[model samples]
Target chain A: AQSVAQPEDQVNVAEGNPLTVKCTYSVSGNPYLFWYVQYPNRGLQFLLKYITGDNLVKGSYGFEAEFNKSQTSFHLKKPSALVSDSALYFCAVRDVRSGGYNKLIFGAGTRLAVHP
Target chain B: NAGVTQTPKFRILKIGQSMTLQCTQDMNHNYMYWYRQDPGMGLKLIYYSVGAGITDKGEVPNGYNVSRSTTEDFPLRLELAAPSQTSVYFCASSYPEGGVETQYFGPGTRLLVL
Candidate 1:
């Protein structure tokens, strides 16, 4: 039961606008989305993944994410927002049955307030 | 490439006193994980390993306990310490490219059970 659902605990953008952080996932087969970024004390920083092809996915500083295979979602984008790009935003889903050892199933974080 | 490294960054146990949270990874990464970040409950997977001696149990492994002979390192063992076992503790490492894998993380360790 791979799960991940960051409905939004906080997300208030301002600096240049355009920012979204909302993910949804529940795997069974074909689903490996991820996007992490934390700051306030450090740890977690890898902002892109959508294992497949062309569903938008482009990570790192500028950030990007799309992969919406009929609403199984994966959305973390940024058009301008700055203010150090806020922080705390995680959404992961990769249990692949757990035998592969790549276990990850998180998503209860989304505090990105980039107001400047 | 320190890639993953964790130690006592901060601690304050008491309840039943017991500790051992140290992780290391120079990148050889066959896999390695141990997570626990509670604020909004984002991360949770108390143990993992796919190399060295091999280990398992994740998704909040009861009070926690782990080990991996050496693929770098992987240690997490908290015998009793309660208070819900504080929070913030992460250590990650990855390998297995192509099939997709990108774990790499470790700048955390802030247990506080008192």
Candidate 2:
């Protein structure tokens, strides 16, 4: 079974400070990891994905994530946080070995709050 | 391109009542999915289709049914509404090419079961 875990329920960061939202995954074979952000009353928007590439992957809205294989983690990062960056972040994973439709399994989600 | 769109932005259903959540995509993607988001829990896959006339159950498919009769539409039907069924539903579409798929999501449908 492929699954992802977001250890933090909520993360608070000051404006202009670096923000990090932790995420870890468990999957068989290679893992396809993805990060999505959802605002109030809106569907999730794709941020970035790690599909057999460099360790560090950059995404939309000045966000990036580091895919650490040894740590089994893919943590979302932003150098400068903005008040408008407050939203719900989700981490999803799909195990390439576990074929058949290739559905994604998402984490419980982490709420990020960037204080001004 | 509309990408993905779900109808009935908000709906209230009573116990034992039933309703169908409509979803349509203009991307002509071969893959479509339905997910439900709870308060604290993230999105849970309810159903998915690889192409027209082919549908499969996802992680959580109880009390819910889905059909993919056309490439552009995938509708989810709830047989009997319950309080536990109250959640936000999202429809997404994607084209799986070379083993990498990027799903495009709809605005979502907020369903409240009383």
Candidate 3:
């Protein structure tokens, strides 16, 4: 079984500053990682994902995440924060290598507060 | 285009009441899923359907039932509503076959049971 952990419940950052939402995972083998953002009253929007190749993956709205195999972490990062980015972020993993299981397992989610 | 449509954006149900949450997707995706979002907890999959007339339980499917009568429609049913079931329900659809196509989500239906 695979699981994800978002260590931070909430992360506060001023606009124009860098921000990071921590995420770690435990899986039997190489895992597929994903990041999603959810605004108030809205469903989650896909941000980025790491399937194979490149350790650094970029996705919608100027967001990116780093996949560290040695550490089993996939941390979401943005160079410049915006108030619009103030929302709930989630980290998910799918271990396709786990004997034909392809379901996604998600973290508890990190609430981001980007202030102006 | 209506990517994913969920009926009754907000609903308040009394304890033990039964209701169904309707979901449809125009994308003709083969896979549909129902997930509930609670505060601090990410989305927990309640049920999923890959094709018509095929449904399966997810991470949390204790009091929920679902049916996929058609390719576009997947409805979630709550037989006995409880306060523990009060959460934001989201419907999502994605293409199947192992490739990593993104899952499109509906606006969400907020349900409160008291």
Candidate 4:
């Protein structure tokens, strides 16, 4: 079974300050991790993914995530937060060992509030 | 490309009523999926289709059914609507070519069961 966890229900940060949303995962084999952001009444938009190679992955809207294999974590980060960045963030994981048609397992999600 | 599209942006249903959520994608992806998002529970997969004429259940497939008769369309059916089925339903598609692929999502359909 592949599962992801976002420990924090909400994260608060002031505009221009760095922001981080923590995510951890459990997978049997190599993990394919991804981050998505959902605005109010909107579907989730892809942020970034960690398949292999670099530990750090850059994504849309100046968002990035670091994949810590040893720690089994993929935490989303931004150098400077913007009020517009306030939204719901989710972390998903897929087990590579699973054969075709493997569905992604998502975390409970974290609400990011960037105060202006 | 219109990407993934879902019809009936919002719907209200009474108990025992049935409805089908329509989803279509122009990306020509081989994999399509249906997921439900609750208030604070993130997303849970209800069903998926790897290709036309092939469908399978996901983590939470209790009250939902799906069919994929064409590559572009995959409709999810709710047999007996109940309060537990109220949530935001999302349709997504991806072209997984032997490796990991990104899933493109639709705006989502909000369903409220009374």
Give the poorly placed runs of model 2, Cα more than 4 Å off: A97-100
Worst 10 residues of 4 chain B by lDDT: B95-104
For DockQ, candidate 1 versus 3, the one ahead is 3
Our model 3 lands, by Cα RMSD against the true structure, at 1.8
List model 2 lDDT by residue over A3-116, tens digit each.
799999999999999999999999887789999999999889999999886999999999999999999999999999999999999999975653556578899999999998
Better of 1 and 2 by DockQ: 2
Ranking by DockQ: 2, 4, 3, 1
Residue-level lDDT for B99 in candidate 4: 69
Q: Over the stretch B1-114, how does candidate 3's per-residue lDDT look in tens digits?
A: 779999999999999999999999999988888999887787888888878998888889999999998999999999999999999999998863336756778989999999
Docking class of 4: medium
Question: Which wins on TM-score, candidate 1 or candidate 3?
Answer: 3
Give me the displacement of residue A23 in model 1, in angstroms.
Answer: 12
- DockQ values per model: 0.35, 0.80, 0.63, 0.79
Q: How high is the CA lDDT of each candidate model?
A: 0.88, 0.92, 0.88, 0.92
What is the lDDT, from 0 to 100, of the residue A45 in candidate 4? 95
lDDT of 1 by residue, A1-116 (tens): 66889988999989998999989898888988889899998899888888998999788888899998889998998899999988898999888887666788889889999888
Cα lDDT over the full model 4: 0.92
Tens digit of lDDT per residue, candidate 4, span B9-114?
9999999999999999999999999999988897888998999999988879999999999999999999999999999999999976436778889999999999
Error of 3 at A77 (Å): 1.0
Error of 1 at B51 (Å): 29
Give the count of colliding residue pairs in each prediction: 0, 0, 0, 0
Model 3 ranges with Cα > 4 A deviation: A95-102, B96-98
On the 0 to 100 scale, the lDDT of residue A37 in model 1 is 93
